[model samples]
Target: MDQLHHQSERYGTDYSLAICDVDNFKKYNDIYGHPAGDSALQAVADSLASHGRESDGIYRFGGEEFIFLLPGQTPSGAETRLVRALEAVRNLGIAHSGNPSGTLTLSAGLSAYLPGHRVSSERLLKEADMALYSAKAAGRNRLEVAPEVRHIVRS
Candidate 1:
């Protein structure tokens, strides 16, 4: 919160945020047990951290969801980087403690700024949430840019 005020010039409100949630993770855990679920989440989080920008911050937004902040990036650029990172997640092929190998996938939502629009931090989160819902609706393991920002260049 302090950062938003103190670093206003350094960190413009222009940043975009993308939130990714693991699809069907609850079912996987309930069926496979918590240990496997923990392993999967850890593996995914590690991969995301490695693939993300040095300046971009990632957070565990509760169960099965992680948010990646794309500072100074346009919506399209955010999507592009995200698509690559997400693809990598799809291919991670981590072995489930119960399934032996090759388990789990993610669904992500992307929110970006429009040409003339500015959004508060809370609004930004909501937009990302909507996009995430759309992604899940569209089909799991896919990316959906916010409707308003879809035209923004991907990557």
Candidate 2:
């Protein structure tokens, strides 16, 4: 994250960070068992990695959460990619009785670092995390962008 921030600072390019969570993961685990939950997580991870751009960094952020670093991407561009990733995971057809859709789904929150913004990487992550919570609250399987970041980018 530090490296990406530095590069963005030096090159004047924008980048976006996203935090995603598997919807109803706990219920899925409770209903299916740990081994099945682990496999489901793996499938979701693979789907996210495959659907993202090669330049994007995808990492398991512990448990059912994952993080994405999209280099040279704006907030909207990152949303486009993340939406695709969400659909890819849904299309995996992993049964999740706990989920309303009866299939695995993902929800994500995104924040972007624009040039001359003077924002710290930590703040960026916090914003994304907050947005992630908002996504979950708004009903999972959707993407939410940090309102502050979006406002800045628009201006």
Candidate 3:
């Protein structure tokens, strides 16, 4: 969120911020085991790495989640990249005897800090969370945009 704020303040334009979470990761891991979980994580990471350009920054936010930073990128652009990443992960076809076909999926929440806008971290995270909720509600493998965007600082 800070990164988005920085770029917005510096360039006076909005950028993209997304938080991706692996769907049913815990159950998938339990079926395959910890090693399988690690493999899944690596696969997701690789997908993100391949989809992102040099300007994009990807970070593993602990387990089953990733934080993506796209500097100077619009919301639509970020969505495009995420779509490719999601597909790449799906096509990976990871081998596991745990679940049905041993496959996995991901969900993402995306938000844009449009030009001439300011936001607080709390509000930013909340919007992202709302987006994520929508994604999960829609389906296991999908992305959702925040219902609304607003500016406010965390108290």
Candidate 4:
């Protein structure tokens, strides 16, 4: 993330980061064994990876959580791609009776770094994390974007 921030700062490029978490994952693990949970996570990972562009960065943030870095993308553009990725994960048809959707789903929170915003990587991550929390709060399986940092902070 720091490297991406540096690149964006140096090249005056835009980049968005998303923090995605599997909804009802703990319940799924309790219902299905850990092995099944692992498989489900793998499936979700694969689906996310497949939906992203080659230049995008996909990584497992931790158990049941993944992060995506979309370089050269604005918040809205990243949202478009993430919305598709969210649907694709749901369409994977991985059963998760724990989830209200009756299948596995992802909730994502997105934040973007624009040149001249002078935002720190940590702040960007915090913004994304907050958005992710909002997504989960507003019913999972959705994407929420953090308010633009530029508006929140004056250079």
| Backbone atom clashes (below 3 Å) for every candidate | 2, 0, 0, 0
Cα lDDT tens digits, model 2, 18-64, are 99999999999999999999999988888888887789999999999
TM-score against truth, every candidate: 0.84, 0.95, 0.85, 0.93
Question: Per-residue CA lDDT of candidate 3, range 10-119, in tens?
Answer: 77776677888888887877787898789779878988898789988898977888878787877778889988887888788875454343567778887767643356
Error of 1 at 140 (Å): 1.0
The residue ranges of model 1 lying beyond 4 angstroms of the native Cα positions read 1-13, 95-102, 151-155
Indicate the worst ten consecutive residues by lDDT in candidate 4. 146-155
Candidate number with greatest TM-score: 2
Q: What is the lDDT of residue 10 in candidate 1?
A: 50
lDDT of 2: 0.91
Per-residue lDDT tens digits of candidate 1, residues 1-155? 22542353355545678899987787779887889888888989998888878988888889989998877777867878888878778789764333323457777888765445455566667878899999888777788887656644432
lDDT of 4 by residue, 66-107 (tens): 999999987778989999999999899999999999999999
State the local distance difference test value for candidate 3: 0.75
Window of ten residues with lowest summed lDDT in model 1: 1-10
Candidates ranked by TM-score, best first? 2, 4, 3, 1
Residue 114 in candidate 3 has what lDDT?
Answer: 68
Count: clashes, candidate 2: 0
Candidate 4, lDDT over the whole model = 0.89
